[model samples]
Target: MPRTVSELMTPHPTVVEVTDTLHAVAQTMATQDVGSLVVAEGGAVVGIVTDRDLVVRGLAEGIGLDAPVGQLASEELVTVGPDDDLAEVVRLMREKAVRRVPVVEGDQAVGILSLGDLAQALDPDSALADISAAAPDE
Candidate 1:
């Protein structure tokens, strides 16, 4: 049987408020060792911010790190419910070209699922090896 998204999702993913500073968000991501954060307000997900977002949108735009995260985050939020099938989640991620997706329960965010997380859960060695091989050499 195929795994459900709930089975693969990282429960209780870290979140940040729209008012949070980009520097603070970066600190949170570093502390949590996560690449993305769900942007929430009043217990509802409004957007998402990733490390790439900081580099591509923030830095490229000359926005200071002290600027509000909401100023640079992608407002077109894409989300999935815990009960949603894994295939559906993958499809949405592919269509949106996003690596991370927030998992919602009603109006609140309950977890997150990333392409890496899903790939690892399904097949660790092969997935990791593939990623490693595709990564640019340092």
Candidate 2:
């Protein structure tokens, strides 16, 4: 059976506004136990902010916690469709060097598919799972 991105995606991912402070975004991530947040504006996704983005783009650049996430978020989003083939989406992820891609229906973000999701779906015991789940500096 051909699987789909929706089948493996984490639905209704935690979200925050583009104007949200980094502190608030971090709090949401920690509370949700998610590594990334869908950056939204007027209920429509505009970008994505990940923990790595916080470190590499926010802290490393000396951007204060009170600053708007829009400054550090990835404005050029690479997204996928819910019905997209899992294999094709995986290929896209590798080609684009993205760990996660939002699953969009029109302009709305309905879910997110991460490399970890693929690892678990394709091979639950694969080493990718360990690497994907590993905490930074581990």
Candidate 3:
């Protein structure tokens, strides 16, 4: 059987509502040790927000913590499904320059497929997977 996204994706990835405040979002990020989150509204993923977004768009712009995360999120979303082909997923990531994509099924965010996930799944013994698992010096 071919490896599907569901086979490799991180299910129930950390999520935050669009109404969530930046302060709350930052706390979630820190607690989960994740760099990004799927931005949801009405139980549907509407966008994505990264730790970089919090710094560049929220803090640097003088946006208060009370401000909604939606304001800083990228409403333009790129998503995939659990059943989709892994090759297509890789292509999308390469073409779109996106590191992560929320796996959605009928407007519901089911899981997340990340480049690291792809690397580990596709070539566990390869150097790319090693690089993907590496962390920068603190």
Candidate 4:
């Protein structure tokens, strides 16, 4: 039987408002030990931001940490539904060149699906899966 996104996704992903500061964004990622966050506006999903976005789009551009997180967030958000198939998730990740994708239910972010999540579910013996399954460093 094929797997569904909800089966492999990390539920209740951390979220940040679009108006949040980049500094706050970084702090949240660090404290939560997550690589990405779902960006929201008016209680609706608007975009997504990753640690790489903080470095490449914000820091590398000399953008101030106090700047709004939207400055660095990828507004061209790619998302999936919890009931969607893993194949579709993989396709979107490939075409969009995104490692993380928010899983939504009626415009509300319910979870996050990441490449690492897929690796763990689909190829548990792979290095990526091993690393994904390992506990985070203290």
Best by TM-score: 4
Q: How close is candidate 4 to the true structure, as a TM-score?
A: 0.95
Pairs in clash, predicted candidate 1: none
TM-score for each model: 0.86, 0.90, 0.89, 0.95
Clashing pairs counted in every model: 0, 0, 0, 0
Candidate 3, run of 10 with poorest lDDT? 129-138
Q: Evaluate model 2: give its lDDT.
A: 0.88
Instruction: Give the alpha-carbon lDDT of every model.
Output: 0.84, 0.88, 0.89, 0.90
Residue 77, candidate 2: C-alpha displacement in angstroms = 0.7
Per-residue alpha-carbon lDDT of model 2 for 7-88, expressed as tens digits?
A: 8898987778889999999998887777898888877888899999999999999999999998988977889999999989
- Stretches off by above 4 angstroms in model 1 are 129-138
Arrange candidates by lDDT, descending: 4, 3, 2, 1
Please give me the total number of clashing residue pairs in predicted model 2.
0
Which tens-of-lDDT digit does each residue in 22-59 have in candidate 1?
99999998887667898988767888899999989998
Runs of candidate 4 with Cα error greater than 4 angstroms are none
Give the alpha carbon lDDT tens digit for every residue of 1-138 in model 3: 346889889999877899999999999988888888999999888999999999998899999999999999886799999999888888988998998999999989999988888887778888879977888445
